[model samples]
Target: MAAATPGLIGAARAQSARKTFVFVSGAFCGGWIWRPVSDRLEQGGHKVYAPSLTGLADRSHLLTKDINLDTHIADVVNLIKWESLENVCLVAWSYAGFVGSGALESVGDRVSSVVWLDAFVPTDGQRVADLAFEGFRKAIQMAADKGEAGVHGLAKIPPIVVAERDRAFAESKVTPHPVGTYLQPIKVSGALQKVAKKTYIRLPEFPQPHFDKALADCKGDKSWTTFELPDIGHMAMLDAPDRVSELILQAA
Candidate 1:
């Protein structure tokens, strides 16, 4: 039998050192959005958890007027605690940033790193509506007036950015996001800042004021390692999974 190669041994050692990752998806989306990136990390022998929030995507059936930011936060915290995961790299995208911030309050000690992917970083008592644009807040109000528990009709990503073949399926999977999640204020105890390693990946192609502010703030902060992917769209994981995976791994 041939002896094991040095390259193979080194690869094994690197894989063993990889940390677990918990990916929180953005609004109107779910765990499915992280598939492109998660698949790559899993292939590299890393544990990755990307659960759909309470009232989005596959879990849309659970939608209710009462599902708020706290509900989504519990979904993430319970997953980490129940699984007994440690050295986790908590990754949040877009609207899920609020969820990640709240979850960190309970499970911050278990997380070794955090990555905010074009996501809002809200301070204490800040709600998504506060950070969101006036247009978005109006949309949420309209959704409520229409007797809907969730909000829809927002697509920040241009059709051209997604692969032509995957466009239809991708559109079908985006369900109405719980309206309460946007309206409810998130209670943050600065747990997100306490993570040993923090990163922020900004996609400049899809411009939004909140995201612009987030990028600027992270760039100014000494603790955060920031990266700007000017070519990628809002959905970096799907638009450029390889690049997103590389960034996530670097954070870990």
Candidate 2:
């Protein structure tokens, strides 16, 4: 069945002072995936920028083996620098924690806050791939061996994760992600701490073990706010754009 076009469940809240947002999408997706949430934010009187990574989304033409985690990080960092955005709220989804977190390293001061929407919150030098469940790793490697994935280890989307309503869009719009981006260890420059506020949203239905520690850590920190959306899945921005946008606005 085709999914109905999603929109805010209710009327938008009163417009708040405009805030700047830079959205980082998860692996395989380009900035295109951020349309729903960004649109809502923009309608609510905010500035939004969702940039595709070097080898994903509309940029799939640039796909090459040389692309790694750092390459993806540089993509967002450059956008902020080139645009000269200040007091920005950096929002990252799913696997983008690695890419987005590392991007903040150099320009952390420009960021007013960060909102990790079920994104991997990596410790320094941690690789996102290494944090996955063991069986998940084997399955990806098998896909690579069969050439179902790209030669450089770019992975095809697993069917199980895509909702039936979302399947058509996912197949048509999603692109292969650089395997190097997953395997490459993220280089953290301690710049994230320079940003004053942070929040981590947990989508319980998805059950990301890697984010378990992060959820706990954020809850304990007085400076950070944590939220849980039990009914939502990993792609909450698509499933619950209003709630996601609210959390983001609050974080900012």
Winning candidate number (TM-score): 1
User: What ranges in model 1 sit over 4 Å off?
Assistant: 1-12, 155-166
lDDT, candidate 2, 1-252, per-residue tens: 965443432223333367999999987788887888899989877899999998887898898767888898899999999999998999998889888889888888899899988878888888876887777577556645564423222234333344456657766887777666766788887676567998889887776777888889888888778998887767677767788888898899
- State the lDDT of candidate 1 residue by residue for 195-248, as single tens digits: 989999888877778888888998899999999988676777887899999999
Residue 178 lDDT in model 2? Answer: 69
* Count of backbone clashes, every candidate in sequence: 0, 0
Q: What is the TM-score of each candidate against the true structure?
A: 0.92, 0.85
Least well predicted 10-residue stretch by lDDT in candidate 1: 156-165
TM-score of 1: 0.92
- For model 2, give the 10-residue run with minimal summed lDDT: 149-158
RMSD of each: 2.9, 8.5
RMSD (Cα, Å) of model 2: 8.5
TM-score of 2: 0.85
